[model samples]
Target: MVIHGREPDWSYVARSVVKVLTVTAALLLTLTVGERALEVFVDVGDRTAQVYGTAARIANPDKRLSHGYTHSGRLPVTTFTMRGEPRRAGPSDGTTEYKIVEGLFGTVQAPLLDGPSGSLADAIDSVEAKPGDGRARATLDGLPPTLVGVGVVEFAHKMTTEQLVAFGRRHKICGGDDVAYIYEPSFYDDSSDPSSLNAIVWNRDMTREDDWAEFAYQCETEPERALAEFRRWVGLLDENDDLEEFELAYGSLKGAADEGVTYGLVFDRWKLADLRKLLDDPDVGTIHLADVAFDLDTWTG
Candidate 1:
């Protein structure tokens, strides 16, 4: 097409061609920008949501201990609960501090257990011994001025929340001389049925010595608070469509208000004598030790 009646002006033709090229470039640039925006906001957002759903499950494969997840900007951070366990494996020199981060992830990446520090395998060692008075007496000699250990006390059968709390009171599982603070209780129903054993731990938030002491006190005086917390977890699980998790949580919560729920108690922190008492109890079916750490400040810090 000719812009003017005169024979096509070369300079005019050149200007028209340049304008068409500029328009095409602009349209392409806009489409590219739109596609990138969609990828970042929509696609990344959906993947992050999926990460949130799987984070807790992946972090806590069996639930003998407590696990939780929270977001840090775009990153998902998962925490495994331990009372005074070292953050990473190291000598009990005063310098080591306990860390809670169990899983950290990116939108497209799987949740990773060990970060730069070390593998959890290196950190948490299984403390093995048959549960009995002999093991209890053996623990008394090695304990430090201040120490933390994870121990599991399995009962012959499932006990209601009331029974567990009463058991705590009867054993005097509180922080003080000759007594160890019960940091949190791991509650599970299908523990005997190894095929589907799932447990839930309560109150990983008690990070400080006083926090644990107070929790131990609450276990005796106001067990209802723990029951309430269990119910709250059930409610939170109800909001999601994860039927497996919901059923497990709900099953634990069932006896919280009425009788109680749990076949055993997983103790996060134990004193020399406290471990002894649990081991000596005829009602306790078995005791599983996870690991121990010396120096309380490092854990509380």
Candidate 2:
């Protein structure tokens, strides 16, 4: 121990100092590395923003086109609102000239022909009779009055259906009656693939009734048979995936039963294009899409 007191080895002291310096240098290097990594992340985020901006600009060359159509000054959404009620065709006067006021999707302003004022039977008569000329003939010849009513209702329903289809197409969402799912375009490799439209059918129905006037008159009268027919149509479409995106609807006169007067369906908005397409397919037949004036404001809400 006394020998150790004689100038403790300076070499050991020098080695300890070297060790501390080495550790300090390594710690400094680590801090520098961490700072560099953070800087890289920031740079990446900025670059991504720039790329997105450029892509958006390129995709929408016209500045005005970015917002798309101004649907009644609002974005389009799914909603149903009565455009207008069928006009009151006065009491059935046999000589009254009943005109097809609004075609299929039209609102009866005042009775066009002499028929019931507020009955489905009158609606049938009005629809059956020639527009303006007063010859009692179905708009689509050979179809019975009941069948014609169903077609009218189908037309109105199809408007809502087609809108849904268009929306699904735009968003690449698979639409059915029940569940619908949409995938972000960013997640897709080939965005054009129809499979990207992932959606499931929930339920659908369309119906028209000869007793619609009775049902209309007695609010409690359930149109079970008509509704069943509609459900059957929906079921058929559901089973066939190809028809899932197709339209469904109906139309009826306000006074079909009473006066034999013609008034357009209460809610008609079916499109002709869709009807044509449906008719072209062998699976479906001579269904007519009635025209109705839709409340643009409600549609866009």
Candidate 3:
């Protein structure tokens, strides 16, 4: 799932864009204005690579990002006598009543290749959606992409910045919600149409804003060490949700230090051997894996 930026509250997904939280008077030290690039160059004995990122703009510190979007589609009218997890996500009057609404913006992109892969919707409903994680991409009818739809998985799933940016390039307009670590796949919509999408623009600019920090640096370390560092980082922010958004969503919290590999485009065709092309193609971006063996551990940059 891609991170759609909020004006002041930029918190989206981890490895996606970051929400610039409110730096209370007591936590001003973490806030700074400087001209240094947030670059990372991982150069262990066996691997070497460069990472480049512009400084995250801390604009409108006093104002939070707006959640303004045109409402589209109809809230699912099919009511159900809620039970299990669905009950908790529904109206909480201690009654077992709930509605299965379309995505925050609306229903799944009309027509379907695989149909509405209810994982994102289910997560929003606080139900545990399984193996059907990742994204569900669809375009209006059989068209080229005046509108595109995607489904982002929850904590027990995987969402990558590369995948998000790939869709952003296909459509000029896009938006997403990162509630409960479950991101509803986003789509592009018209600005003039009040019924069209317009919460956050999902373009390379915003993608850069989300991924710059996460992709900029990574080093070799034991899994336990990396987990400790991540927990500490979350503790420093005192935002446990941030940890969920970043680490838990991808199972990276107790995982090892990442190699920070991301491909320039999104595709399942890539294999571990494909990384050899990185040095051949300067456009390819990544931090070396060294002796750190991995399967198809890559991201679409």
Candidate 4:
């Protein structure tokens, strides 16, 4: 075709051919890209639907998930650097290891349940450890003494590819896609002292001290579920000020200005079997647990 006021010359024809080829190439590229994009979109949608047990894609997928509480600026507890000590001469005396444990935690008990439970109290009293009873308490070492409040510091070891895929499938969080096969999505830091607000989820394979990952998979998948659980806990809170103070300390510690003192909770080996039993339950997904040094002492101070 002739240009505006241009002659129909060989140069014009050549330029027209180039322009036509360029336009045709661009259109083909656009269609190809669009078709490939549609295929990817359908694939992702179908897989996510399968994860959620839905027959179709739901509207507004992004808003529902609690993706790492982007506003919270939370960091991993495992990120805390442990002080390295020279190995002891006598078969590597795990003394320093235990001492560090003592400084951070008095005794590690897998509480039958989280919180100031009579069960936890009884667990403290009934532990089979020889001399760690009344006299033992968490020392002020290894932890920053001036910490104003406590937030949960969790050390979540990685999960196996199979387990992660299964968890994602069961929970409908991710479809075990390679990109989403990460521990970050499941990690949660409940600075809320109650620790009930943020619960611990045991890894199916509890190799690392049995408390592998405290990811809020439930919250990530169903954020409202956490709020509902929080409400239920609030309703259970007694009228006693002491109880309120303790829980309030837990829930609000995250808002503290500086790094507050955070302690640890260790699960005694004896209780692991029972915890595993609970984990096997179809209804139970994750348990509520914390690393904070609540009152582990059963004796008079």
Error of 4 at 192 (Å): 37
Off by over 4 Å in 2: 1-84, 87-267, 294-301
- The lDDT of each candidate is 0.41, 0.25, 0.22, 0.25
In model 3, where is the ten-residue run with the lowest total lDDT?
48-57
Which digits, one per residue and each the tens of the lDDT, describe model 3 over residues 147-241? 12122212222334354344233432123221111122222235532222101111122112233254321112221222333343323221222
Question: What residue pairs are clashing in model 1?
Answer: 87-98, 87-99, 160-260, 161-260, 161-261
Give TM-scores for every candidate, taking all chains together and pairing residue i with residue i. Answer: 0.44, 0.18, 0.18, 0.20
Q: After superposition, how far is residue 5 of candidate 4 from its true place, in Å?
A: 25
lDDT of 3: 0.22
Local lDDT at 1 for model 3 = 94
Could you give the candidate ranking by TM-score, starting with the highest? Answer: 1, 4, 3, 2
lDDT of 2 by residue, 143-194 (tens): 3222212222111122233343443344333322112111000111265433
Error of 2 at 55 (Å): 60
Model 2 has how many clashing residue pairs? 43
Q: How close is candidate 4 to the true structure, as a TM-score?
A: 0.20
Residue 114 lDDT (model 2): 20
